[model samples]
Target: MKRFLSGTVPRFTLTFFCLWLASLKLIAQENARKVIRNIEIERHDVFTDLNRKPRFIYSWANQLHIVTRENVIRQELLFKSGDEYDAEILEESERKLRSLSYFGEVTVVVKTEGEAFVDVLVTTQDQWSTIVAYVFEGGGGRTTFGGGIEEFNFLGLGKRIFSEITHEVSEGTQIQLRYTDPQLFSSRWTARGNFITGPFLKDYSVRIIRPFYALDTKWAYGFTGFARDQTRRFFANSREFDRFREEKEEFQVFGARAFGSRFHKRRVQLGYRFSTKDITAVPDRMVVPLPDDEVSHALILTATFENLSFVEETQIDKFVRVEDLALGNITQVSLGRTGIPFPNGVKRFELRVIRSEAHQIFDRQYLFLTLGVQTLFEKNTIASFRLRYYNKFARRQTLGINIEFDYADSLEDSQLLLGGDSGLRGYPARAFTGDKRLLLNVEDRIFSSVNILTVQLGGVLFFDAGNVWSEETSINLNDLNYSAGFGLRLGYVKSPDSRVGRIDFGWALNGGGFGIVVGVDQIFSVN
Candidate 1:
């Protein structure tokens, strides 16, 4: 190299040496400047740009390796760029997938695909697992209750295919079978299950999620056909006491039902429900109101509408989506667990009440009114009106104190409620056998995180005051009963990273033994 630079007698070599020395000195001076800057830049949080800041952005890549049930790689998913330091974008995409609530865990890692690009890698959680459960009950209506078992798989054959089967043998025998397809056929058609169970006899039903609907939530609709053959018994003594006596005649009914619901950002709709029944084979000797008519089947219609909004301009993420600006003073969720046929001796006594703008309050008070219609066609249909009020109690959540008076020819029925599992403890389900039932459960819940899991243990004082009577004011004190209990509850949250939280509560009665109930999702199953 010096030879090439030399002009004569190594003149170029001399010149090259001089230039090299000058350049080396300049580099050394630059290094010294850097060292001096580092010494003066002691981190004290005074200037954040250069103190304790993220170094190099640590660019990463996103990768998804999906395989078959047999661990065979099928395909991989990639975003626009391979290795990029867009933490916000990566986190957002990962969050969307995690919201499915189907995985046990998920992590995103960035990898340098090229000089300035990165890809992401998503690692999924565990797969299908086996689960089992057992329950027992002893009550006035019947005894000899036992337990049951259950098993299901969330990821089936590399897709969202699930199935569950449960059986119970107690006062009677009952069995349930269900299969769900997260992505039905081609769209979001969620196929339901078929159930074969009964109190006194057996019944069968098959349901499906119908396509070709309206609205974005047109995710699915349910169409079901059910048939049941059973008999009703008479407990001659007390109206509250149900004696398991066989009926004189055999009764059969074939029915079809359809259900639809709509869900939005803050609104929930029980959409609509329509059911038609065809009844036959009523023995002539039975003591039915329409004895001579042979008691044909009746059509039933059920509908519900609900809308929830936040008083504060904030989003609330109780168990799922959590935002900084959201205020979640109250958290509640309601869904139908199962449906039952209308109670016997009920053609003219239907309870109806409507509430409008009861949550919003002004001048420290809010009120709503509701009315009911009686006897639409026959003595089987009766209606009533209701009114409710709310006031600021302490926190942002309003104190829900409402009044409802249902006027009906009768309130005698054996039909249960949707969320009956989380109500009145210390008593067997369907324990309250009466012509009229009134219940109130007021709760004040406070939440905190314990051991990384959101622990929501609330204080609930409940009072169940009701009377058993053949008619109004004819109620007998001997049959009248009231129960008050306090509840200690633990709530489990639904998360994409961790297992969904569980809620289990124990309630102690003033005059009864404590009751312990631990179950999934549903609040209660009390009748």
Candidate 2:
């Protein structure tokens, strides 16, 4: 027995020692591959050089704009000195920086120093962060005019401050104040607050969150509260028929934990929500009954799956700007229940499922699809589907198509509307109201190489068709409305937001006459 024990112990000890040596060697190799030696950051102002025409004006503009702080850019990076060197991580860092509206250009370059060391260089160009201008939007004979001042990068930090005063046809004059800090207190947390007041409404909201800013983020949490008191107006054929006063308060808090790698991830979240709503009908103009008042307290659980894949393109949404499109799949499912007995002895339950998928159908064509379903058991249900397709068939040109459908069961006081403001550009706003809606939009977008005083230009020819039906009416293609239009686009290249302004003219085929639509940004989004 002693002889056998001695032989077995020696063999086992030698094997274990060899395995440990192998593990140590493997770890050393991994460290050699991942070690980063130094990082350099270069920040440029709105104008890197003043050698072009209007040099004096460009110089003055650059002097007026404050370049972003080095720390602000450094804080957003996912890797730093002594961290692992990963190409995907570097690309993700570039994307993160580019996503910020304040940065007009971002690039990350890496140089291998030795077998175990690499140097990274990050470069960024700033945009004009302060905007002071008049905002005007007119469509279907209705016009909303306003002016606002916004500073997207306040004091060289990634903060936003905005104040605006606007006059709308339905709600009269309104004043709004908003502030946001993407990196609150130089940390990952974000904070935002908004207050709006008008003759017919008062609203306020506050949100604080430490979100999953990266795919490998392990935990996240957030809190949001909102309150609003407003006069809700119902319109038909662009005419107000009924109005009510609604007061609502909502509060929600959630925490999530993520698991998996950067390429594929899963997140599980738990949340609690409390909300109350009350309605009062107008005394002399009560054409419709008021919605029922209710209070709810619920607990919710949600699971999410995200497959991370992206494609970078230019001239798709904004001219001369880089845009990243997610070409992966995302799915989420949520379940909620108000299981506790209330004063009214009523219980409620809710379920929501959302899925989105994107595909590269061809070399230059992409398609995106989204589906959503939500239900409050025994109360109401809503189902919506959207499809967006884009073909970059030629340089500086794209063909974009969008299709959307929505259906609601047991709709109460609310209405599903379609009109000039909602993709059916020929008719007035709220010209069609129903429980089901279908809309299709096609655009041949042509981005010009012309730049007039730093402003890029583009044009679009579009066709729109849509129909809406009440629950009592059956769906019919013959009842569809049609509109054709052409528009001009102006891309503000120097602005921090890179805003695109559009003006469109439409001719209605179904009795509605000519219409003009003016707005900011692209009319539709793929997501």
Candidate 3:
């Protein structure tokens, strides 16, 4: 035993031991398989039978198209008649089907057909994904109104098309169009295009992805081309810089592969970008120099591992709710390098790591945490962490708390500074910026269900406190800003529910003033 611990064992012995362990696991898996004698597909309506309930005739009238084809459902199945039953494969199939925006709920059940055979039943319920929407959104002393039409599952072929026109209060109007084909030309390749035009911004992009998901597939590939006018209003150490614009064109190509399991994946990407900047309107007080026209070429590599589990509960024709949410774990790591003998003469290396996890605790309570670390080779390192807690203290009530902290060592102007736009509800966009920041948010949510009309209404009261500071200044309690707000949540009833919209009104305690935010099911997440 001592010799083995000291690495005195022969290499062949170690290899044999590994092979033996793998064989044992394989044998166990083989023993678990039962013959699958039959496969069945069950597809439900896009909307619940709300007519059964009084005063829900509106739901019946709003019914759209049934966009998912039976063949589309069958193509995603991991098993077929005479195939062996594997629980992991079955769950994976369900997950893949649910990932489609058109699907509200996906369940795969296996039942014994005879002594040694089982039947596979795959059931799927559709979601109302065709949205012709009008938006009137305002927040943080700004207002934006827009209108859009989106078909998420066009003609049941899993295609998407969206077009919108918007007019901002102070900013000018904008028009946008987006289209996507998940299965291009009846193949596995996916294609996407986006276009946006406005007085201050013009952006267009096209992308294609050949994803690698099959057990026998070795690699995936993606390519993208984009041209955009990016505007940035920089604020550092609580001081603002005049708006800066960069007109840039970029092209990128990437390839990736899975290792050991589909949940673990890695990719390498190469890209070239050409940019010309104009900062003529930059304030004279700004200390940073404006960037000149230049070109850049770079390579980036990334790896990610994801494993999550969740359960979806549905009410017939009314709504689907995801309860017992558990994020097993997810981690991503990336490294990038720029200017390898490039024409633009740029040189930089960057690395980042992100990890997130969620689990239940003590029956009715849950905890979720996310951590991020980033570095620009040899110069600066930034780390961010967030911890969240959720408690279901009552049948229809929940309490949520989120705490976040961010720090930067030797910060640079080119780096992204922590700012209010992240989630300081009362503060205007970019109102605060600094090398370090801290935030705390607490929320109490109450849900009320209107089953007859297939509507779910929720109300939330929240408190937010946070501050950003520079390296030269220490964080002060007096410098912190506080915001108290109430928000309304509207969702449609169904198995696997959908958020219809949200409206928030907040009051600032530290002279930031009052703000109201309106959104259509848009939720913010810490990046």
Candidate 4:
């Protein structure tokens, strides 16, 4: 190869290309794709980086089998049996499971095996939890404190359920119930049954959400669905209670997502979704003054492109992304919610954030363009930072700072905030937000399990700080209002992460001993 390059190119060019190819392409090939049937992994070869990322290697090292139904993978596992080719199947399963943060431990066992005909045993870690959780809200002469019982494994059938009740001095009682089946149709889909009736959305909302994922030779795609129904009196009317009436609203939504990543060069994340209500059958008067029925149907769509470059020789990571191209420069919208009644929420922010990380605006002939530059940075950190100036003619302008951090690239204390309820644990699930506000959470976590099986206990010290401000107030960063205190978090995490999470018990100090709070899903993270 060296001889050929030398003769085919100028001496200087050949030298430069060779070095470039070695530093970049050498590391790239370490993650290049392979035919599924090739590069089999044994216990000793489990950690090999060839054809796989390091995380997959760590997951595969603990892998067991590949559970499938009708040729579709149901879940990934981390256990093995003497009768099955556990190593191989587990590796493939890890590829699918990592995309989702809803499982604790997912393993496929060989139920009954003979020759090439193997019956896969799908086993999931149980999530049975007993939790007392709480929340409080009051900005305009109203404040409430409440808590409830939340559980993960309702009946040992891998089904999850959570029920909670809370109260405020004058507001009222809040009750919620929820259940979900991670594998609704065995593979490629999920469903949830939710019920809620409270002072705010003072209505019962029952909705089903399903997500489908698949992959071809090149890219992968996923789809999700959300449908809900709301009842009347979902809100409080200061004057009515004796003869308060009720109304109902039903709606449905569908969303699609697609992603593609090559060896180690670039990654493309894109998707679109549209939702509308079928309120034709409802009576006009049955609708409350402002209900889902009275709301307009809308559609949301977004697309993003990102490129990554790794200079292994120097161990630096440089990548850039541009998200939510549908509405350029829309920096203040959030859409990750299934029924938040907004178009392109999380998606648009995702695109803009991507661009902010991996791209920069450049001009050369009086025309400005966003150039995504991929290069190595200090200490080999995988960084996506964006520096942008609005004007095409002037270099002096307002700068937008957007940077995303990934611990997978960390070389040290990075992992300190990577595990358990550490970073963003203020209000589990990163739920602290405000306009021109400050969000902060400090948790000192101590975990002790009852012999690693029957039970697990965790104690936490937390400081939750942040506040919401109306447009009427003058904004000041130095004078950001915040609340500080400590709390305890206990988990009934049976099949945590790759397993299935059932109950998340969170109670913090809201100026008192313990304020009960409940969190949904298994992935309770902040970073």
TM-score sort, best first? 2, 3, 1, 4
lDDT tens string, model 1, 80-154? 332234454445434443334333334455543433334445554432233333444322223333344333334
Residue-wise C-alpha lDDT for candidate 4, range 253-307, written one tens digit per residue: 5444434543222223333444443332234443222212233333334344434
lDDT of 2 by residue, 1-527 (tens): 88986797889998999999999988887676757789899999998778998899899998888899999999999998988788888899999999999998899888546667889999999999999979798887678899999999998998999999999876589999999999999999999999999987899999999999987799999999999998887777778788899999999999999998887999999998888889998889788677788788888999999996988988777888788898889999999887543334236779999999998889989999999999986756889999999999999899999999999988655778888887888678788887899999999999998988778999999999998898899999999999998999999998875888999998898886988899988889653
RMSD of each: 17.2, 6.5, 9.6, 16.7
Q: Using TM-score as the measure, which candidate wins?
A: 2
TM-score of each: 0.47, 0.92, 0.81, 0.42
lDDT of 1: 0.35
Q: Which of the two, 2 or 4, has more TM-score? A: 2
Best by lDDT: 2
TM-score of 1: 0.47
What is the C-alpha lDDT profile of model 3 across 1-527, one tens digit per residue?
77776685677788899999999988876576578888888887765565574635535533556647877777767677887767777877776777777787678888555545788889987777777778797666567888989888787777889999999877789999999988788777889999999967799999999876554356788888888886655664435555556677778787776665554434433333333333343445445455555456777778877676654322211224443254568888887777753645456777999999877676677778999999976656889998987677877777778888888876533444433345667667556676778888787766766443556777778888888787778978788889998988676644223545668777887865877778754233221
